[model samples]
Target: MTEGTIPAALERAAERFAAREALVDGEVRLTYAELARRVRQAARFFEGHERVGICSPNTWHWVVAGLGALYAGATLIPVNTRFTARETIDVLERAKVSALAITGTFLGTDRLAELGSSRPGTVLRIPVEGAEVPFDGVSEWDALTGLDSDFVSPAKPDDVSDILFTSGTTGRSKGAMSSHRQALSVAEAWGECGGLTEEDRYLVINPFFHSFGYKAGILAAILRGATILPQRTFEVRETLHLVEAERITVLPGAPTIYQVLLDAPERGNHDLSSLRLAVTGAATVPVALVERMRTELGFDTVLTAYGLTEAVVATMSRPEDDANLVAHFSGRATAGFEVKLGEYGEVLLRGPNVMLGYLDDPDATAEAIDTEGWLHTGDVGVLNERGYLRIVDRIKDMYVCKGFNVYPAEIEQALGWLDGVAESAVIGVPDAVYGEAGKAYIRLRPGAEVSTADVLAHCKANLANYKLPRYIEFVAELPRNLSGKVLKRVLREENG
Candidate 1:
């Protein structure tokens, strides 16, 4: 029946919900059949390619382009739209993508022009906002529609469907490869938990490049026949407007999302009564936040989940879970995963949905997944008697900065290139708005003078906005242990 893969799932959705509204992107409203036909038309453009990259904001185009690549038997590479031209080019070059679909301009920058020198043979400039200027070597996505394709070479269940890059502790990003079955399996599990239905309207505030938005938001909506409304960026007033205007039933994001909505002055001005289900995770959800989200925000169910890009949807809270439970623990293992506590309380997972491996990095993959088939997640957590999990700490130095994972090692590495840089240490500090922000302590080279502005400028050029340290300080020397390894714990203690 070819029913175990995402392409097969989309076909089923096309047949089962042909007349149902499948996607609602700004001015483009498409039903299931219309969405399917559009995906096929775009798929014809991706033929004879092995890997296709999409670097654009969330919209009808991102969905169609991503699915089109998969339908043409090409692995999808979703580049972060927040990435700088250098960072975006690095991902595209490393993946050796055969084609790329990017936005023309966003936030005053011409992204298509920025990526002009990229190696992709075929380029499609996606229309976002403002004027869509023509690029010399790029084709327009809007003009690529209406073509037909009779060729059928959709990916199989075991084929790698997407390569999502996640920054590692090594200061470089690693691409995690999820097969078709693994991606769709987690989506099915997530949809079943949220009780998604065609009658539901889903607001996707999370970025499309992220697993939360792609797997849980888009794929889950497709499987359960929910209507997807893709918001390019999250603004509090716009979110409220959409909730009231579209009668949004299912909304999921980090705890910060709900917190903002709760604290907004215009919250009561809009009719937010249709918000029913909210799936949140990434940072600790305060008990007060959960209660307020339910009673004040009018959400009937609020759940928390814990997972990384390697194996998304490992554990998630159930609808019947109490507010306290939802606030404290991520629910029991789902998506056919077995969660266990490894050495030093490190979280371990064995499942059907665990990623195949990191792209072209066997040694790294071996370190992540052991011979016993368990993926050793570098997180420390405790499981209750009922198997619910509460993440207490991270064994790795990675921290969540405003819902995005920021590796201090990366910033530290970037700092090494500065003229006066000698040694550096970065640690997480508590923040009221972002939950946690990076604090960098630096020691200059002997007799070298560098202003704070110099370091800040270097960081601004090298790192993404979320990866930039919120605070910086100059120190004479970094605290070290007997073996001369820098003691980051001492830094966090002294400063944080």
Candidate 2:
């Protein structure tokens, strides 16, 4: 791997594979040279900006804007498109974002207008799937073209490249800071493990807001010279059609992604033989699912991985591993990283790729990474005789719903805003499509007439779509211990 910054890597890729296909989005296509020019144009557009925020779905515009910020020596903060205005504003404020690339009125929601006067300095409104509602003082996203005199700032390997916010069990989200070196190193490691090459065409269904999509999906494609096809949303038929139509060779997502592909009634109608590599993780993986993915989906290589935002790619299965090993274990520690069990079998990792620290929070940083540099992950896992890690329990009350972590406390805090509900508890339950789904238990105030529809409506407005609970049940009283703490175990058992 080249010991250079992301922008430098992009420059190298442009020169090495100038005419190679780099991006494909809807009707637009760009070669590596053209993609580099587009990124420079975006960088020139954001000349004076410092920290940049992107709050849109996966698109070619998102790719250019995000890379443009990094290329211009600004810290990139990718905001979840599913978040409401309030939630998005919280992250922007936390990061002190000076420029923002937000889509105009998407899917009947004017995210820009919703942000109101609290909006950041510069806004690049990308016109996506919805009518562009009139908003004041915004620049056109697609109109950016590099001026001959525009200067692009260079970034160092150690400079922070991105600040990705992740919710914790404490109900507040923390920004995980990664330097250019860490991001590029992890992307290269992932690409090498998957054997991503110039011959491969990757369909990135993962959202760009998360590491799996941005780093593993897009960044890896840049480093390895794979053609990237961004799908803004995941639908059963459309996804299958993309695979068959584009001859997508490399696809990585959660187990649920493969499950839906297998369960699709029209699975027989599509020619998915071009699929070469498939990576899935972040939730339970049944051996049968792995076997079926290999046998039915016709993927030549299938691997599972275990990672958190703090350490992007801790453990991952190699291509040669068997289906049973791939299903049961999350591979061994990758190169340049060491994984060991701390007290009570807690998984601890030490690596150059681990996040530098939480943004602007020294105390929390100290608590997470120890004096010896081992990050004390709150996940419980057991290493097999051959050192493959199998995650068994999460000490934090968090669950993976469709590859994204859903902390119950975050949803519970959102539910607290409802008018009628006195208290609520959220838990994860098994789902056929989404590996796990959220189930909320509401304790209404005396004589309160809040219905399930009301709870769902409030959640839809405040929380991201992934955080919304699929099940809502009202309760007279929540089971509590003598100390007045809600017994979540009881709720899980009763739910069962």
Candidate 3:
């Protein structure tokens, strides 16, 4: 495969696996050669655009358009499908996007009309099945893909590949600019860490906009010549059906996804024997869940990885790791990365996969990456003698209760062991006695009842009084971003 750019990697994949199945969406399949041909054609259409925005679901169109933009030497910007009109406009304007490739409608929302007149670029609508959306002046997908397929723009390793906007938990989201070299490095690291083979059928449920889905999911698959089955959204029944139908070999998502599948009544009805590898992260994963995924779910290997948008996949557990290590730790640093702890117990990373900088935010970029080139992750963690890293919590998520520092991730991990608790989040709230106390928001299993007193009693047995939650509130569900991370800022704002 080519060393730096995604389009170069695509060209190599097409040569090696020309007739192999490259991408699969519902009723849409493309071989590597066909996919490469379309990408080249779309590249010709995007020849003049400096920055191209892609707003679509996890489909063949999204993958093709993104790679095409790269091939045409345009920096790709993936817009979150869940963003509001104002948020979308903000991204388009901030990125200085000159063109957009978007689906007509996704999940009952007319994406074109949502941006409306606020968009500052040319819009290109990707036609979806059974959708007839009208637009005044926009290019169609057919017209773009019908262009000449021989044109290929030159892109260097230092060129910006994509600008990924961070989830605005702390404040306004900053776009993390990643170069072609960084993107290719992360993709190769993920594939090597996961032991992905060309024979594996990868089911990508993560959103295409996120670094995990785009770089680790699609780009990694292309690097290894693995067949990509892109799912628009996560649905337990639908995923189960796809797993059986496609004989998927590699499946990765958050811990909640596997938990839901284990709890499904119809899980046994589906033939999941083809599932061999599973990778998950984003929250506290219980050891029991890891064991169940291996023993009950029939997965040969279950791995846990840790990374952020700035560095795509820094640490990941190997296939030989035990369930406890995989659950309790985020694994050692991957090859080509140096992971260390700061003076305040914050995790710091230095590697090729580290992003170039935040787009248009020099101050924020300087604050993030220090003079020594270390990316301050702002996550509290501990490195064991064996070199495994255990994430305690976000440095901002730590709170003082009665003069003792308390980490919400520790409390959340303890809560996961509770019988009826399906999911939980702890935020520091104002307390009369202590300076700040933790308030636990919990979502119980369906039809399982557990009161606040019961939860407190369980915590008393498992945790110290200072570390125990001061208050408990039962909720139907926890608010999560598109990436499946609990919106702790939302919880803190609501309950603070």
Candidate 4:
């Protein structure tokens, strides 16, 4: 095993459970030995690359290829499958990806090898059971698809091993280069927060390609020698079935997932009692919802955490935090993390877990991380005298209405406390004269009748006029990624 890589941690896990199930999907399970073999085979295909692209849907293949890349001493770039062909082209062009291990045809084209070969890179199509490579002259993902079972991890402590593209909400997406040590630090911190152990079983509902899944979910689980149940989609019923059947011990999902589960009528039929810990984050967790789940589902330990693609699992509220506060504030930055309240109360983080920098964009990197090494989080929060951090809102999410500042979080929190409101998202929309006005998109509780005017009146009574949303749009549900973050930018564009 090499120094400073998750593959090193995974190797240790394999030793403990070589024949144990490491991945499962729809009755399909891969033992530790099988998983290690596939990973090595994938690595052999990329024997001499500095970087490789792992473009696949949420599956065990993505995990194997990612692990293989690190084991082979190459950086891995995880592409978002949701991107259009044009958007996918942009990311591929910018990253200068030398090779690809792809699943699912992109742009109605089956040949990733042909599409990527023209871009100064070789594309390798991963083998689909008993199938041939889709493109002529292109290497197959299984070209060397077998390992010695004596596979070892290879990575430098300071090697930047993964390049994750930002969510691109604020602007053009830039890749965050995370070093092995940095990734491991965050993963270790997450393991501690969740009280992970080899006895625990995790359901991998989050995409393995994302930073949260790679570092906190998958890597942390691997470090603990825990089993991972992978899901290719976020179907509520399918997820519940896995939890019940696998007797999953630890389940981490976005708040939206909980909301959906709670709303499911058959939710009561699933035996979620086996779930000891429920880690929720990527967005604010509603206090009422948390309380409901605790009272109804019996998950006493609901931990809320906060982090981004740049820094995986920064602040997390432990199971020890008051459920109310945990729902309110994703715990303070993890141990060794430094949070400084900058001018205007924007929270800035200084820690070993910060990304190496945005890949190939020195200017953006400089703007995000200061000379002092603090990553400007662009989030607004206030530190209480007790040193607890309370997120006020995002800098970009704050709007000015009639010369007064309105933070979306404040409004969302207020609206969330109301009856029959499952989830809420506040965005600033164009106003004729007030410059900008708050627009609230809400998802109501099942069978609950809460009129727009009634909600407006409720906000009017509790909040100042500036904070009151001028327009209210009731949505069936908020748009979210697999991680459970409300795609506010998506809503803003659609509404605009």
Candidate 5:
């Protein structure tokens, strides 16, 4: 594959598929030409800006600003849409963002004012909806949109393109700096591995703020010259309708989308035969659901990939991978990526896709990536003899039990396999006998009933006594981040 920048890739594809649909949202369809033009206009909007912050929903504005910022040779700070005013202000200050582009009065919050206070002269606000207004020295969104700038800032492989803030589930959020080359590398690699072509049409479900959503959904489709069906929000029936109506070839989402589709009664009525590839990750998926997609939904290819915001993407299970293995392992490490089990059994990664550094926090950067250049993933994993990697559990999530190591995922997986169990979360709780003991939180399927004693008895058959959860509690829903990852730290705090 020829190595080229993201803008170059999109430009080349636009030449081939100029009039072809690029992003389709019902009546609104953006062709490759239109997408390029919008991206260029966005780049023109950010001319002379050092740092531009974008806090918008999953829509054309987000993609346009993201690509535009990259083209303008300015660092982009993506503020989380769900963040409170204080949180939003925190991200802008940490990233030193001078300009901002937001959608729809930023959900009626005064966050823009809060951010403006930090950098008075440099603040530029662009509203995603309606005509942009000049607010506190910021240019109107439309005024910046029409500016003509012939300057095309060529991005090097190593130049910082975007800054993505962490979810801050455990602590303060840090901005991970991603370079143009690194982001493009992951998108291109995924395009090749998935055998993406000009004909494939992908439905974009994941939020574009996340690495998976940006690289996998928007950028990857651009590189492949494939069509993108962008959904502002995910609904089971609506997604099914789009997949059937557009003949969507690729469906990439977290386990929640799959679980919802599996439970939808209309799932049987929809024509999902067009779905060739279903790539999911960022959450643990039950093996039964994996099998059901193959037998019921007619997904010929279902893969699970594991990666973080800093690393972009590291590993994925191939289409040829055994269904059971795809259910177990997160494929092989992506091209230009290497994974090694550290002395502490933690998954350590080294690759070009690894983030350059954290914005304004060298200490946190150094803590995450060591002197040896290996990124400490803090994930417990083992590489099989066949070179497939299976993440056992998070290193931080593992607890000690009477001098024995207890992995929450091991117990959680066992619990999920039990009858009537839908989803489960396991956390370490303080115990008098042992320093810490495993506690399980469960959410049963609709109309399904199971007792704590029955769950414990079921786990006893699948797990060793040492790994058995000491306590069990049933909950209506488990605590999860926007990305659908269980926040075990929250569970531990609650147990305390």
Candidate 6:
């Protein structure tokens, strides 16, 4: 249990729980001993490489490849599956990846061909079960997994484990370099916070490319002796079936996921009695929704956590907290983190979970982390007297309308309280009178109807005059990334 590196941790788990199931992906299942054997075998393929890239969906292959890179003393870079060829190439080049392990196709696109002539150094193809896609001059995953080797190079706790890129919502994505110690600290904190146990069956709906899935989902399960059920994407019916069949004990995702489940008519028919722990965060959560998930859904413990890619699992609502406090604010900082509010109401953090710096960008790194080691989270929040943090909105997302600062998150939360509103996003638009005005885009619940006037009236009663939205437009859906975050840039580009 005193392992310093991720691979070493896996080794310890294999020795203790060799017969326990470690991973499950559809028809594929691997126990701790089997997974460790495959990891050692795959590690030999990356023996000489310093940086390795993994571009695949949430599968056992992705986990094996990533852990194998660590066993070989290589830095792993998990590229986003939704990234275009240009974006993928940018990451590969910037990370100086010496090898790439990618699937042939994903969502009907030939991923390998899309990255045409942009092979980093060695290209390894991970074959999908039903996909008949083909590639030339690429090594197959079987070749690597079939190799016989037990070599594991020594890795220190301070060695860089992975470089995770930001979502680039405001600008170009910056790679946040995290050391092994930082990554493991996050896993330990999350595992303890969620009270993960050996009997828990965790269904991972979050993508592995993001920290929410990689650090909190997979590594946390490994830290405990829990079983992992990797889900590639979120679908209501399929997820319900898996939950019932797998007897899933732990399920975590964004608030939108629970909303979809609550709206489904067949949800009541599923035997979700096995569900006990539910964790969600990353967006504004309504108090009503939190109450519903517990009272209506029969969940014993529902928790909300707050963290960014730079610092994973910084604060989390404890199980003993009331529903309103869990919904209204992200709980107190974790044991190792120091949380403070800056002069301008920005949330600041200093902890082991904080990243070392941005890769290859010293200027950007300096701008993010100060001389005192406090990471300026670019987010506006208020820490109450009891130390709970209520995130207002992103500093970059705030707009000045008529000389008053307007926060979109506050408007969106208010809109969620409306009768017919399913989701809403607000952005600043050009106005002739106020220089800039609030424009709201909304998606109503199915079979629910509400007029623009009704929405405007509700906003007028709940929000200040300057904070009220000047324009309202109803849409079927709002543009969102894979992580369930609203794409404000796309909305601005379309409306502007």
Please provide, for model 6 over 1-496, each residue's C-alpha lDDT reduced to its tens digit, 9 standing for 90 to 100: 2367898788888888899999988888899899889888878888889999999888888888888888888898999999999999999999999899998877888788889888876888877646545567788887875687668666678899999999887788999999888888889888898899888999999899999989998889888978989888889998899999999999998888888888788898899988899888855787777887888777899999889988988899888888888989888899389999996799999977789999999999999999999999989998889998888888877898999999899999999899878778899999999888999999887888899999989999999999999999999988888888889999999977
lDDT of 4 by residue, 1-496 (tens): 6756767766777788788888775555887777777777777767688888877766677778888888778888888766655666777778887877776453345535335445435666654333553566666655654545455556787888889998777667899998878888898899998898878888877777787777777788777777877776688898788889889888777777788888888887888888888887644566788888788767868888778888877788876788767777778779478877998899889888788899889999999999999999898888766566778888888888999888898888888789999889999988997899999999898999999888998998889888889989998877875456777889889767
TM-score of each: 0.81, 0.80, 0.97, 0.93, 0.93, 0.97
Q: Which stretches of candidate 4 lie over 4 Å from their true place?
A: 105-121, 127-133, 139-153, 494-496
In model 2, state the lDDT of residue 59: 88
Better of 1 and 5 by TM-score: 5
The lDDT per prediction is 0.84, 0.83, 0.88, 0.78, 0.79, 0.87
lDDT of 3 at 55: 89
Indicate the worst ten consecutive residues by lDDT in candidate 6: 127-136
Worst 10 residues of 2 by lDDT: 478-487
Clashing pairs in 5: 316-331, 317-331
Per-residue error for 109 in candidate 4, Å, reads 7.7
Could you give candidate 3's per-residue lDDT for residues 429-454 as a string of tens digits? 99989989989999887778899999
Query: Which ten contiguous residues of candidate 4 have the minimum total lDDT?
Result: 111-120
Tell me how far candidate 5 lies from the true structure as C-alpha RMSD in angstroms.
2.6
Best-performing candidate as measured by TM-score = 3
lDDT tens digits, residue span 86-202, model 2: 889989998999899998777678788789899987998987875575666888764686354244557889999999887433457789999999999889889988999999999
TM-score, cand. 3: 0.97
Candidate 4 residue-wise lDDT at 136 = 62
RMSD of each: 11.2, 11.1, 1.5, 2.5, 2.6, 1.6
lDDT of 6: 0.87
Task: State which candidate, 1 or 3, has the greater TM-score.
Answer: 3
By lDDT, the candidates rank as: 3, 6, 1, 2, 5, 4
The clash count for each model shown is 0, 0, 0, 1, 2, 0
